[model samples]
Target: MNFQNRKQLIVQTVDERGSVDVRELAELLQTSEMTVRRDLVQLAASGLLYRTRGGAMKVSLATDQFRFANKTAVNADRKDYICQLAAQDVQEGDILFMDCGSTVFRLCPFIRNKRITVITNSLPVVAELMSSDVTVNLVGGEVDKERQAVHGLMAEEHIARYRANRAFIGVDGISLQHGLSANSEKEASTATAMARQTEKVYLLCDSSKLETDKYLYFAPLSLFDVLITDTEAKPDVVAAYRKAGIRLIN
Candidate 1:
């Protein structure tokens, strides 16, 4: 194949699998490994992919220097602020259930120094806290590649076996009218399971996710003990949530 075809194929592989292996690309294109590396360098320079020691990763996956690729990268600063607010609720020696939501993943950094145990279904969460003071228990189940988490009947059952002091979760949309909804039912089920076994549930969402609705409704607003969002939340909207008896920490 020509150089253009090889380059396109390399990009396609990364887009499909989230990362590309240099050896695999060389074999697939019947080219030298050096040639593949050169192409990866150009792609990385163009911001199409990120070069790793062994391969190239999707651009979004490199946003946080993690394995999971999330669209929340667009509003990264806002999400970090939101998660920092949520992290305040965590105390030492607490058992927590962390979700796969990008917003929830942001919580890892803030609480890494705390002495606590975390039960989660997110692969990114595991990678984030692997070298930290927090102990991680990953739920076993079918992998959801797009979300970079695990969710299924097995995952829900696994979550049921453990109880936590707090559960930090994310949602596609959350509002008083629609409650909590998600674009993926499998993910919704995992969230429900986590909340069910937790003493308190904190919903970590940004302003854009507030006052919106998705198709699959999972839990109601009543399930959450607190809603932590960024400063972008409007005064009246914050008041509405407070009036509904849901606490807000911003």
Candidate 2:
């Protein structure tokens, strides 16, 4: 199998069986033990799995809280501040498309009382808005266990069926060169679908993501109606974005 396909299968195997023995993986993949070892090392380095003596294991919450908690803990206050800034633009009776971004999730508490309809793929977003005044439409798809979100073809199709006034999205990285990007195709596709179906798009990104680029570029800076960030953002960086015609609300 190709590296990408092998990688996905490796991750799925760990998710399904809770762990993967090197010999078993090699047999299942029809590759060598060395290939399995190399794959395990790469996955472990990427925080996708825990490397064991002769195999690898799933990255459960207890082990590391996976990427979701680890990412949330990083610049938690900054993320909240960015979200608060984004919340200022929200209006009553608006329909919003929220993505499965930790920063986007923070906007939930601030917008709880607004009579808004939220169309989202985030499990956390749906959970937070469950008892609120906001009406939620969760897209149908496979649950991404680690990210606590729904993704895949069905989710994209569901998102395409609805239109929104505003889409509050997140990015793994952003840059003038590569635009707004995500670490995985599933995330990129979902965000792209939301942006395509929304009238205006708001990017909720922290200062740290400025000028950085990730694996998949889904949208350009021009796609956003406004970029909301925390006050910690550098003046020059904000100026650069504004100069490039990206409206900023920091």
Candidate 3:
């Protein structure tokens, strides 16, 4: 596997088991202990994990908190479905604002062949689209190692200078009370900036996120033009979103 894919697996393993020994990871990855240690170092630097003497441990954050790689592994099938649905709206020449959320990252492969411009803060998104035909403009700012995205005032300022036809974002929580929220203020700010600069905003998430609330509330239900989710979403919750004038695609 490529380094990024391998790093993702390492993050998943650590997340699942809570902690992982370097030797064990090396065995599981079929690579050298040195390489495993190197991976752990990079992941730790990004705030994804805590490196120990001989292994790594998952960071203890709030309940809704998760590293980007770990987030990618959760609800894999649902996220893939949502991403596929969201990709249907992409036009060849569209300029897009892709958020740093894991769900948004899934949209990368589906839209790779289309000739489009993507402005994003997600590191994985940039890596995923680097070799594809899509034009990628990476926003610069403070890097959130755990989220594998850029954030902070500089990033938001850079995003403001450009506009997009569509914006695909991910949220930690979505509820009638809070509207939309994220685990950190930085992420919320970045998403908000993207939403403001786009003509249409698509919130890509799984059904579980509905009715949930997280650390930072960013936008209201009215900010999103559409929500793409898996079919397992609760009927009442789905209805509520539609009633609020946000399009729902299950």
Q: Give stretches of model 3 more than 4 Å off.
A: 1-65
Least accurate 10 contiguous residues by lDDT in model 2:
61-70
Cα error, candidate 1, residue 150 (Å)? 0.7
User: Which of candidates 1 and 3 reaches a greater TM-score?
Assistant: 3
Model 3 pairs whose backbones collide: 46-145, 46-146
Give the candidates in order of TM-score, highest first.
3, 2, 1
Give lDDT tens digits, candidate 1, residues 125-154: 999999999999999999977678898999
TM-score of each: 0.72, 0.74, 0.74
- Residue pairs clashing, model 1: none
- Report lDDT (CA) for all predictions: 0.84, 0.85, 0.86
**Candidate 1 lDDT for residue 150:** 92
lDDT tens string, model 2, 60-104? 732853357555655678888888878888899999999998889
Kindly give the stretch of ten consecutive residues in candidate 3 with the minimal lDDT sum: 60-69
- List per-candidate RMSD values in Å: 12.4, 11.0, 11.4
